[model samples]
Target: MKKIVALVTLAILIFSCSNKKQGNMLVQGQIKGLKKGTLYLQKMNDTVLVSIDSVKLLGDDTFLLSDNVKDPVMYYLTFDGNTTEKRIMFFGEEGTITINDKIEQFGFNPEVTGSKNQDIIKEFKKIDARFKNQRLDFIKQDFEARKVNDEDKIKQLEDDYKRMMRKRFLFTAQFAKNNADTEAAPYLALTELFDANVRLLDTINNSLTPKVKASDYGKRLQKFINEVKANETK
Candidate 1:
């Protein structure tokens, strides 16, 4: 009887171990167009993309990615084979990765069939937007801190950013909402400083001194402005 019990226990252990494997599924599909003709499904904010995993693309545009996904995580579909575009992050589901449109739409398209986890995905998107603004405010704050020469205050602001960046999208966005006014002050100050900097830059751009005419400093200032404008989100 004891030997039979041991065999049963061993079988259960083997089955449990198999079920507890490291990964979940990743469903991939390509709607319209071709070339590489592949799209990637991956967990959001995660480093590596699962290439060797089993992903299915069906005739009706439904797909499944199966691995033992660790937990419910923020995941997005990326078209990295051609260009750098990431679909919105949604709470991952093993059921399906749906794409309605035949071709990829780089920007957010509300009508597009997204993850099986619809509500969670929408919430993730909302938080993502809010977090973006929160960080933008931080940029402005940086300029202000420098202009006022407030080293201590700058450190505090920097520390806050450090802490915030460590959090997930939802938490960070919620935190931003709660401390909206308090957080925005630094960014506003920075924006003012950047404006002043730009003014100085403009005034000096058209007229170069004997020393200025000798080098590319004027052009460099203009380049800096252009770069900043390009990178600044909204």
Candidate 2:
């Protein structure tokens, strides 16, 4: 009889394990303060989990992230790349769970729903994309002028180039402040932008702007310096 009981217990354990889901999370919600943008659902452990197995987000204020969890773990919401004040998710139950919370992240009335933070992140992403697009066009044009060895025009680019970078730095700083209560998405975005644009601007100023290189590239660099400076004064 003991042997039979042991066999039954083993079978039950096996059955339960088999039924457990591997990718089993459905997080969804709406962020009322947003009009448009990309949002992220990033998980965190020792390091920030920017990328996850399931990439689920949409423009209609909905999202789903799936993963198996025997124990409850913490997840984050990335609104507009601001990660510090992210929405936290806890999965301690089996079936389905829901949550609703309003954040003072963006404004006094910014809200999140369904235990997920898809709403705020998406809206922020939209704004970030627009800002990037505006900057990219100028970057491309500045590069194009240099490709043909137009040494004269390089001086013109620098006036506001560095200043623009500083602006981006400042803008990202603001972003960091708005999302100050939760995860780390805003910080991550600010870090990346600082590297890509601000640091690059500094490098250009230090390495390429001065000493009057007088080459096509140099002319472009000068132009950026002038632009950055002019913008700064304004």
Candidate 3:
């Protein structure tokens, strides 16, 4: 009976080891102050978010999740399958990526590392925030001008707004073209320049490196450009 029990235990261990998840990319992180929760590593699958791997924490805050990354793409780290809120979004690629955040803050601000695309995104956000503030200021000015019925002021504000928008669009297109070798190039063009002229979008798309053009975001950018062009012809 003792020998049989030992054999059964060994078999269970072997089975568990064999079933362990292995992949090219590893996402490991620690959520400080978290005692218990479930962490899920998710990615988009044909417009649907799907979990690739998950870990349940019983008395610890450390977690490990991984997936077979074919190309650099955006990924989400969420708790308890609740991706709708308090989720950390990062660019995922081959190799190990480390993310560290406080459970109290969660996704508000996470320190993500090991992805070059993410670095570019961080850089762009800083400048983009300035543009956002300027836009808000313009909105307030426009509202005041219209309230006072100042036609000359309103017309000047309108012209200024148009120029600001043009500047923003040109900045975005140039930024994308500057980093055409990275997957983030197409992503930026798709997200930031989507409403811009088709010519600007085409310029950014045509500047993408071959490797980047083959990435997930690259394909999406191309498809979006085609759709816009088709609409113009209609």
Candidate 4:
């Protein structure tokens, strides 16, 4: 009787531990060439970034962190290496995520995996980079025109810059509209298009499905739109 009771107790404990691990988000990463430092896992609560877990490294560059994540959301990985602090953002989901990078390029060039939203963000960023590069080219042309004291050229460059900005806004609106069922839709609006024209923002908001509207980011987007409209009326 004692042996049977002990076996049952051990089985229950193993099952409980397995369930706990499977129910939470696991982030395991390695920072190569890092001899000493602290890595922090952080998330935003309203307006503040709060640390949820931290690991101090002495000789090993590897660390693991886990947290209960109810939905896909943004999280930050911050490293303090006694010299400088570096931070990078990623979307955290309920599964194992792997990150690997050198300490020198921790935030700049880390290989991250396991979140679908992060993949979407990567695609959007490529489009955004092209727009930014075009804006920079316009700025350079404007400077050249100013040096030559050519009013007509300067005016043309200014008009081009304005058109580029309008195009960027339209691209963001279309991206959100086409991805309304994904979290990326609301995220793009909240981060990139909050200051966009109210009419355009409304069109993106209307494109979201009922389920997407109830998500955390979706709710925040709705609140932001309301605030922008209120400010316009004021």
Per-candidate Cα lDDT values, in order, are 0.47, 0.48, 0.91, 0.84
> Which candidate order results from sorting by TM-score in descending order?
3, 4, 2, 1
Candidate 1 residue lDDT tens string, 1-234: 999999998798658645644444444444454234344555533356444332323233433344555333445555543224545334454454455444555435623343443553354457667667878998899889989999998998899887656553235334323322231212222222244334333334333344332333233445665666676646
Candidate 2 segments exceeding 4 Å error: 1-18, 21-117, 189-234
lDDT of 2 by residue, 73-170 (tens): 34555566566656454422233434333333432233434332244354556667766875786688679878986666655656556666677665
Clashes per candidate, residues 3 or more apart or on different chains: 18, 46, 0, 0
Best candidate (score: lDDT): 3
Output the lDDT of residue 22, model 2. Answer: 52
RMSD to native, candidate 1: 20.4
Q: Estimate each model's TM-score.
A: 0.37, 0.39, 0.89, 0.85
What tens-digit string does per-residue lDDT give for candidate 4 at 1-234? 999999998798657645654338888989899889888888889888888777667688988777888767898888862213577788887889888888777788778898877878888998899998998899899899999999999999888888888999999999889888878788998899877788888898999988778888888889988998898899
Give the C-alpha lDDT of model 3: 0.91
Best prediction by TM-score: 3
TM-score of candidate 1 to 2 decimals: 0.37
Which residue segments of model 4 deviate by more than 4 Å? Answer: 1-23, 81-85
Per-residue lDDT value at 3 in model 2 = 100
Return the clash pairs for model 3, or none: none
lDDT value, residue 86 of candidate 3: 83
- Which 10-residue window of candidate 2 scores lowest in summed lDDT? 181-190
Sorted by lDDT, highest first, which candidate order results? 3, 4, 2, 1
**Per-residue lDDT tens digits of candidate 3, residues 1-234?**
999999998788668746887799989889998889889999999989999988778688987788999999999999888888789999999999999999999999899998899999988998899889999999999999999999999999999998999999999899989999999999999889888999999999999999999999999999999999899999
